[model samples]
Target: MKTYCFLFLIALSITQVNAETSIAILDFELNDLTLKPRTAAEINRTASIKPLLEKELKNAGYRIISIDLAMQQKANSGFGYLFDHNDVAAELGRTAGADYVLIGRLHKPSFLFAYIMGHLIRAKDGQLIGNYISETKGGDEKLTLKGVESIADKIDKDLDNRYTPPPPKHTTLH
Candidate 1:
């Protein structure tokens, strides 16, 4: 009886370990912002979008993760997050045993093109998961948020189907 119980416990533990799937959405790599007039005045809440992406993922039921401080430090010192941190994000995610590591690069139009172009990559094998080269375009950071929303919405929907965590509940005090 004890042997049977031990085997069942081991199986349960294995199942639990396999159930955890983590994903990290790095900062959106934005380029071409420099093209704007020197006095264009930066877009507000632009930095907040990254967290919004993470929130959207969490709301969709994905487990978010943290990268190493050293790698983060190096990545923070650049215009492009991956220019110096691509390998680091992947390596850190892998080292931390993440199932998916999401990285995005923004290729804003040069005031001539009509749409924003973005690159989203998967860290599993360092392959491009998807690209955002839409036909529609808008100028400035607000437009960029819309682009991000579109991309994040697609990913969140896919994740929603794959992993359906308990639906979030809202309650208001009387």
Candidate 2:
């Protein structure tokens, strides 16, 4: 009983931390392929993108904000339309009041692979901020997350830069 109580306490603390460092996850975009996504296996394969994205973001220390919360908090969810990264981040920040929002898109479909991209933007200003795009081949799940991690890492480093602005520019007459 004591051990169980300790575990529960630990889980609760982690949950609190996640809640504090909240991030909104906007919906992913999917383009229609030339042919229908047929076969149960193909359908399942096609569906793995979301799970992989969520896992990767979580692993990268981002507290994921689910669609449900986004809808409930913002009201009227997204109209199946994902805005640009900067717009998404600002809108979600106004809604969920999060520090950042990640907008993802998966387009131009092909067989045995999924090509996706993600962009992180600062909610305060509509800037490109950071971006990550990847094409995973041979149906490898690890590659999907690896791509995501690469992007996430890039965003992390950029965030650090944001706090420390670049040195003043010098324009001397030649």
lDDT against the true structure, per candidate, is 0.55, 0.58
Backbone clashes in candidate 1 total: 0
Question: Model 1 lDDT vs. the true structure?
Answer: 0.55
Please provide, for model 1 over 57-124, each residue's C-alpha lDDT reduced to its tens digit, 9 standing for 90 to 100.
66656788866656655656566656444555566567666656666554544554333344444566
Candidate 2 lands at a TM-score of 0.58
Off by over 4 Å in 2: 1-22, 37-47, 67-80, 160-174
TM-score of each: 0.57, 0.58
In model 1, residue pairs whose N, Cα or C atoms come closer than 3 Å (at least 3 residues apart or on different chains), thus clashing, are none
Show the lowest summed lDDT stretch of 10 residues, model 2: 159-168
For candidate 2, lDDT tens digit of each residue in 45-140?
A: 446665665665565566666656546336324533444436645665556666666676655477766666767666566566667777766455
